[model samples]
Target: MGQGDAPERTRRALAAAFDPVFYRTVYDDIARTGSDPLRHYAGTGWREGRDPAPWFSAAAYLSRYPEAAGGDPFLHYLDRGWRQGCEPAPSAHRERFLERIGARPHAVGAGPQAAPRAPDADLPAGLGRKAARELAATGFDAAYYLSAWPDVAAAGQDPLDHFLQTGWREGRDPSPDFSAADYLEVNPDVAAAGVNPFLHWLAAGRAEGRPLRFELGFRGRIVARLTPLEERVAAAAR
Candidate 1:
């Protein structure tokens, strides 16, 4: 990425905004190919109308701003489209999402949503234990959960057991990058059904490409997808 002037500036800004892990996790096909996520998106994925992140939809944005068709929709959004009140998703949904994000309480450990959850006795045996196990193997962070909820940590609870019993309904996050409120907000059905949001996502959402949380903490796992020569150039500059 030995770039200069306006193009390079945009590239770096987009790189900063990009989340390689989020891209790969959302699209298993991209992960399966082992291509650098940003490289793919910059080169062809965007042209294919693929989204760069969960919060931004390329095709949807393009539909709103056809003038942006000549350039990358993600770049355009970061560049100026958002200032123009562009939406990355359906207008109504995006409005709600923006309001939720702005409120901030929708984040970890905010307590059970306004809606109640089924009592512990009503939960199936090992409700989210399986999903929790699978996510742990993939990227779930139980320690993060405890850290977010001091009471749970103070009580020396088994992180998984507590989450299965009460933590989720209380809006406790299982992983730092996953927000129960964010998931439920986008997926009202999961919230309505009383199914574990994380479980529903793991068992079904992954295949469906349903939206979920992408915490700000892990924004750039691998966005700098420059070639080896470019890497050397960047390292030399550093």
Candidate 2:
């Protein structure tokens, strides 16, 4: 084959390997636009809020033939069209593209096995896996402690540890605070009452079963969201 024929051959090979379902979905567009399906998808498939089929189909294609993908298949496909003289648009989809292909941002830690659990690990046992995943994605660690020991968790010390050591002492409310340490300094009444704020919050606040206010980090900004533990439990049940 001539040097110039190699890209066309590779393109043909990729077309033969394309998923049938994906082909049918975009076939009309391909025919109408007179474009190669693989190149078309390489340019447009892995976008957020679009149909996931194109992304998944591209992933399935790579998974079926590992050699074509080399060391990093997603990146390989991402740059393939551009390398063949297509415009450089795929780079813009880097984040979503990596996500679609299940690539991790960092290598998995090989440290101690008994390392401290992520805050989401403390999620109530009743929460279903889906709900737990959603909460974790939203960074709702405070809710776990709020449901378990509102005042103590709000007070900022480890809720379980503080509860075990001090028990319920009076005047220990970490009132209207961000961290347990902060609450301790500010809430003089709780300090004088000498009660375990953790236990007190559990009995008085948690028992009432109010929705917990927590911050959610979305799209690089923090937004407030209210969540009741019972709602999560119900979602789990469903």
Candidate 3:
């Protein structure tokens, strides 16, 4: 490779790892301008600590591997970071994604492990419309949903629609304490049935006392917490 080919090589590598739809959707300023997501990212996004996809958190990557600074995180990872066993998204599905990248190191930027997990953001709505609508009428928090998955907001799809259609199955969490992935992981029946996890919770999990996420559980209900609890239920609960 000639020195002149470096820029093109870099672009190709970044393009393989970068996700334009995720970029435009997650970041409001970019979405508002409707600029080419890749151009913006290559030009300024990485410098500003912007992530390429849900599986890759730029800020986290830089923090974890400060040596990756002054260049694109994806390039560093694809070139040698993965070989060094560098982590991408610490908060996302780290294990599964790690397996994916390790298995297909050359295809780092092709797509997230979304089909085995990611629904193509461009595909027409198919499965989750009704579940989404039903979820909408419930105490579904739109603000929280957007904050949790800014990509959803960027994609221009309704929050519930995305959740029911893609979010739940993809393991996108609906709230701070509720994990869509965990709910599905613990319940293969629900996963196989292809029912929305949150909807399943509302319809049956709540009655069945299904746990949400690993960290989302109540830790044996501390005695001090009882002071704030409703007295009527506290006595029996304790």
The CA lDDT of each predicted structure is 0.68, 0.40, 0.65
Better by TM-score, candidate 3 or 1: 1
Q: Which runs of model 3 end up more than 4 angstroms from their true locations?
A: 1-4, 90-238
Q: Looking at model 3, which ten-residue stretch has the lowest summed lDDT?
A: 214-223
TM-score for candidate 2, please give it.
0.18
Give the C-alpha miss distance for residue 178 in model 3, angstroms. Answer: 32
Cα-based lDDT at residue 171, candidate 3: 77
Q: What is the per-residue lDDT of model 1 for residues 104-130, given as tens digits with 9 covering 90 to 100?
A: 234555755564554632333354555
- How high is the lDDT of residue 157 in model 1? 90
Per-residue lDDT of 1-238 in model 2, one digit per residue for the tens?
8989876765554444343333434345555666655565546643321222233333443455455443334344433532332221223233443433343233467565645654333334355445544433332244454565666756777643443344223333222332443333333233334433333333343465421321111211211343467988999999
- Local accuracy of candidate 3 as per-residue lDDT tens digits, 56-137: 7777888899999888876787666775768677424334433433422345567656455334322222425455466544
Q: How well does candidate 3 match the true structure in TM-score terms?
A: 0.39
**Residue pair clashes in candidate 1:** 112-170
RMSD of each: 12.5, 22.1, 20.3
Best by TM-score: 1
Point out the worst 10-residue segment of candidate 2 by lDDT.
214-223
Clashes of 1: 1
